[model samples]
Target chain A: MSNYLSLENVGITFKTQNGPFRALDDVSIKIEKGEYVTMIGHSGCGKSTVLNIVAGLLTATEGVVLLENKEVNAPGPDRAVVFQNHSLLPWLTVYENVRLGVDKVFAKTKSKAERDEWTKHNLKLVHMEHAMDKRPGEISGGMKQRVGIARALAMEPKVLLMDEPFGALDALTRAHLQDSVMEIQAELGNTVIMITHDVDEAVLLSDRIVMLTNGPSATIGEILTVDLPRPRNRLALAEDPHYHHLRGQVLEFLYHRQLRPAA
Target chain B: MKSNIVRLTPQQESPPEESTAVIPESASNAASTATRATKSVEKIPASTTRNYALWRASGTTLIKNIFLPVLTFLVVGVIWSYIHSHIAPEIPSIADTWTRAKEILADPLAQNGPNDMGIGWQVLYSLGRVLGGFALAAIVGIPVGFVMGMSENFQKAVQPLIQILRPVSPLAWLPIGLLLFKAVNPSAIFVIFITSIWPMIMNTAAGVKAIPKDYMNVAAVLRLGKLEITRKILLPATLPHVITGMRLSLSIAWMVIVAAEMLTGGIGIGFYVWDEWNNLNVPSIIVAIFIIGIVGIILESVMTLVHRHFDYSR
Candidate 1:
């Protein structure tokens, strides 16, 4: 598979009150077309920093990021991000929030009806059609996250970026959303890069799990490939030895090999 | 009868049965029998008791909210009467003030001339000035506030000037307004504008600065145009704070208008108060005081309603 997104030797430094602070150093990763990759690490390990770099919300202090052979210098519709907090505008209804992205990305090329249809279609993908008229504040946390996902998907982005999108949700809700995302990925075959702290989630959803070391200056620690069959069921996987092995491998890596001192 | 017996038996038996299972059955039998007998006798329906509780709750709330305030007003009236009868006679008794208030309100809209207009006309004239000045302040203040909020350097440059000007009494500005405009009405309005503009500018700038980083990040990621960001994100986000500023500005304007009008000598409630005081119509002056208080309360309550309407966070 051709590399659809690549970050080469990416580094980020912050000028804090105490002087220069390196958040990430010499971070490099290549994400292939139609692949679902997740970056996993403990807190403050620059997992989100990597995702932000790809989203073009942050410019690296060193190296370069390329998306489809184009330099990723600024945020655009091409890379749509589902933020950790599900940052839907409180004043807007679910439909309007999704429409905001659709209108911005497609207004020049698409008709109004086409944009509306696209918005509705994306909301339907996340089963948020029922709440299309409800404001973000009126919905449950899970429903808000679904709307966030719909908003990202509506942009018809080249790559979907998620920064611990289900981190705030309960375990059951997170599992249900992970299943929905897996199904959506299977259907659309869109490239996805997600940042997560959950080991089980990394094993369940990702084609490749890129682990990062703890930071003051963090870098990629290891990469693990999941060769599990698609259309994976959690209950069935609970009984599968291979699935258990993958879960164990991630646990061992997180706890034994690359565990943060404070954690 | 059978269904009633069934329900009562379970209700009466379950607790004792469970307790008997834990303890000795023979030991609790007499106590259980006594309790059952009392429970059967006192068979009030659950719904009726619930309804009674709800009614009592609402009655308590009504007494707390309505009755207390009315009682306080009556007590204040009694105290005022006592003080007028026993203390200095210059302060009009509540009854005397009420009588004068009735007389003034009876022909409130009557007009002999600009100098001798009714209380209603005076109030209207004052309201017009306050609103005009407030509207002008809003027009000028909101944009300046936005600019200051959007740029730190601009805020720093403007901060010292605003600090120096803001705390200077609105009455102090009256002389400057008189010098600049050389007209009573415009000078009164200029005082109102000067006083009211500060709250709007300060509150709106603070509101703009407080716009959450998450919303800005969304704007950045979406690549929304400058106009779109301002219209969709900035305006709505800062609206509650802007309304709060407007509320403060309006109350300040109302206050300054009374003092300003007293100095300017126009057909206003404030002027009416001064006129009554000059003629030694103490009761009528008291009536004017009550009217001023009532109008100020109304203005504040109206602004509070507007503020609540724009408060999207709740």
Candidate 2:
């Protein structure tokens, strides 16, 4: 399959007062166009660091991130990130936050009317059109995340980088939002790379689940293909025969290794 | 998750009591006790009454929290009046202070000296000076603070100088201001400017530096232009702290103005207080002191309200 984005021999080392800590180690992955890939790992396993590298918010200590055959040297509108905390500007209304991205990336290209229409369309897609005038503080956590997703989509990014976008939500809200995001991704046909810790979330939402090992220089431990057919139901997926096998394999690979001593 | 638990009821009942076998003694006793309680509830049909009691408990907690402070204030007032009447007649009772306060208000212009103008005019004059000095400080300090916060090189270069100047007394700037401006009002304004600026600068810088990293990431990914990001992200993000700083600075400005007026001897409430004290008019001096306190409280409260108005989040 042709690749839309690629991370080649990518790694990161953060310099601290104590010493340097390697966050990622020679990690390489290729994402195909319109493909949904989930990176599942324990916290501090360099999952977010990898997403930051991909979003060009942080540079890799080694290797290159190529998007559509071009190197990503800095952050650009081609990749939009939805942070775990839903970093909506509390001062701004929901519409203004989404309009922020549209105005920034498409100002020279789109008219005022077009921008407004685009913002409203995206808000509507997230079912936040009614709350467009409300400030971020006035909305619930779930609504804020929806606004964040709307803002990311309004950028019309070629690749969407989601760092545990639903990690903070209640399970039911998370599940509903997951379905909403999946439906949107399908509709928009944009490549999505989501970082998550929930095994069921990874299995239900991704074409491939990439698991990373524990840190002190972490790398991809295994990549599991989720053979379950879409559109997925979390309840049904839990009961499916393949679901247990896949869950067991990932759990064993990630945790069982921790029980073994160094070679 | 709620539905999941509810849907598992049949399965739970059909498990041949396997879960009971796995349960330890303490847990089984707890569950059995809870089951007995639920059966009792079913027999009585009084769970709704228990729920009503629970609701009342929450309501009582809410009312107690709100009423407690007001009750404390009333009790304090009674003790204050008792102490005033019994121990020291020299001490102004709350009613005496209020009467004097109302008398002053009834004829503020006449109570104020003919040459002194009115208390109203003095208040306005004092307000203008405070605002002028504070506004000047904000205009100059915020941008400097933003730059200092955003750039490491700039922060390192200027930080030591700021730290050195910040601790210098407002009076120390008075002499410099007098020499530089060569006029009483302007010099006094300058002193107020100097005295009030450091907090605004320091607090603004702190606010800017403390901005969440996630916001910068959002700005970067969205390709927000520098101007847009500064307006939308940087400015609004720092506003709460900025308002807090301004509140602090306004009080400082009022204090510095009073000191400045005392030193400079101008037509201001500060000067009025000094003038009354110099003339040894004890009652008017007392009046001036009370007025000053009241005005200061009002100004502080106004700033606080403005701060709260803009501060949406808890």
Candidate 3:
């Protein structure tokens, strides 16, 4: 089968006051349809840069990004990004935040009722239907992230991009959201590219973990395919030897091989 | 009250279970609290106790917010009375001013002529001018600010002019306004508009420039059009700052209107005070000063309410 999404030697250089800054260099990855791929690295390792390139929020300075045989040049509804900060408009309620994107993408194609259904259905998927009337300010951090996910999913994007969606959340909230995301991915079979620093998270969710080297010009250091079975329980995987082995590989790649320089 | 507590208890119990069950310990802890609350309800009528707690809380808040301020005002009044009676008898005594205030306020809408109108008419006239000038500033200044914020070149071009002109006195603009309009009313409004426009423009520009990058990123990823971006993202994000600018502009406009009216010799509180000063009516001038202060306070409080309504960052 053809690759669903591919980045062919993508690199991004930002011109800062100090000088030219190479955030990513010669990074290439091929992701198949329905794949849950996560890019994991240290804080400044250009993992987010890779995701942004695919999302078309940032243009690659050197190489090209392809989605289903088309060049990814600008942000569109095809690739919906769940920002790390859960960037829900403060003035909008949970329902309105989700509906904003839903209406934008589906207003012409679908009826008002259908669009509303899509919004409510997506919020239901994230179990955020009850707090639909509440604004982002009124809700907790975890709820806001759930709404962010709902907003992204409501677009029915060909590829879902999440940049540390649960990084700001507490451990329990993170674990719960991770489980929800895993279930959603399984059910929808949509392609996903998530950026995270947590190893256990990467192991738990991703079909493939793409590890990156430490930066100035970061690139893919290793790719580990998680061979674990579906509906992977966190408790069950805690004791499973194969899970540990896969988790250990990611840890080794991140810590031993690509150790970040001390500031 | 009883119904409210009963309704609140179930809502408080269910949210943690649905949203926060990832931390089962906290979930169960919340459940235990709900049970404990039920037990307490059986021991004592929950409504009465909750009502007492509510009453106590509100009582304390009232004391802090209202009573303390009133007490401070009383202290200031005593000091003012002492100063007027002992230090400078030429300055109207508090009692004398109170007497004049009573006489003037008894028929506040009375109009013998344009020059000899009641205190109410004077205050209303001043307020009308302030609002007129303030509205005009908002109409012109906000858009200018939007342009300044959106375009770096425009901002660079206009910023120097704003800085140079902002500190010039409102009275300085009066002559220019009189020359251009050749009318007292429009000139006064012109002075008010010029004085107030700077804060609105500066604040709105700063606010637009300070929009969080994350929101802009969201706009980009969603492929939102320019109009949609401004309507959905930019406007709401800048609302707090815009309201702040409006508040500053209003207070400055109020301050400038009085000075402008005093120069223009119109039927306003400022002109009324100046008239009283000329006639050596110290008690009437004192009353006018109090009215000016009270009106200023009311305008500021109204702006504060508006500010609080739009302030959603919390």
Q: Name the top lDDT candidate.
A: 3
lDDT by candidate, in order shown:
0.86, 0.81, 0.87
What tens-digit string does per-residue lDDT give for candidate 2 at B141-215? 888888888999999999999989998888788888889888888877788788778888888899999899888
Question: For model 3, what is the C-alpha lDDT against the true structure?
Answer: 0.87
Q: Assess every candidate by TM-score.
A: 0.90, 0.82, 0.91
| TM-score, model 2, chain B versus true chain B | 0.69
How do these models rank on TM-score, best leading?
Answer: 3, 1, 2
Specify the poorest-scoring 10-residue window by lDDT in model 1 chain A. A254-263
Complex DockQ, candidate 1 = 0.63
lDDT of 2 by residue, A148-231 (tens): 999999999899999999999998899889889878877888799999988878878898999998886988888898888877
Residue range A22-134, candidate 3, lDDT tens digits: 89999988899999999999998888889888999889999999898899999998999999999999988999999999999998999999999999999999999999999
TM-score of chain B of 3: 0.82
- The alpha-carbon interface RMSD of model 1 comes to 1.0
Give the clashing residue pairs of candidate 2, or none. none
- The DockQ-based CAPRI class assigned to model 2 is medium
Interface C-alpha RMSD after superposing true interface residues, each candidate, one decimal:
1.0, 1.3, 0.9
DockQ of each candidate's interface versus the true one? 0.63, 0.61, 0.82
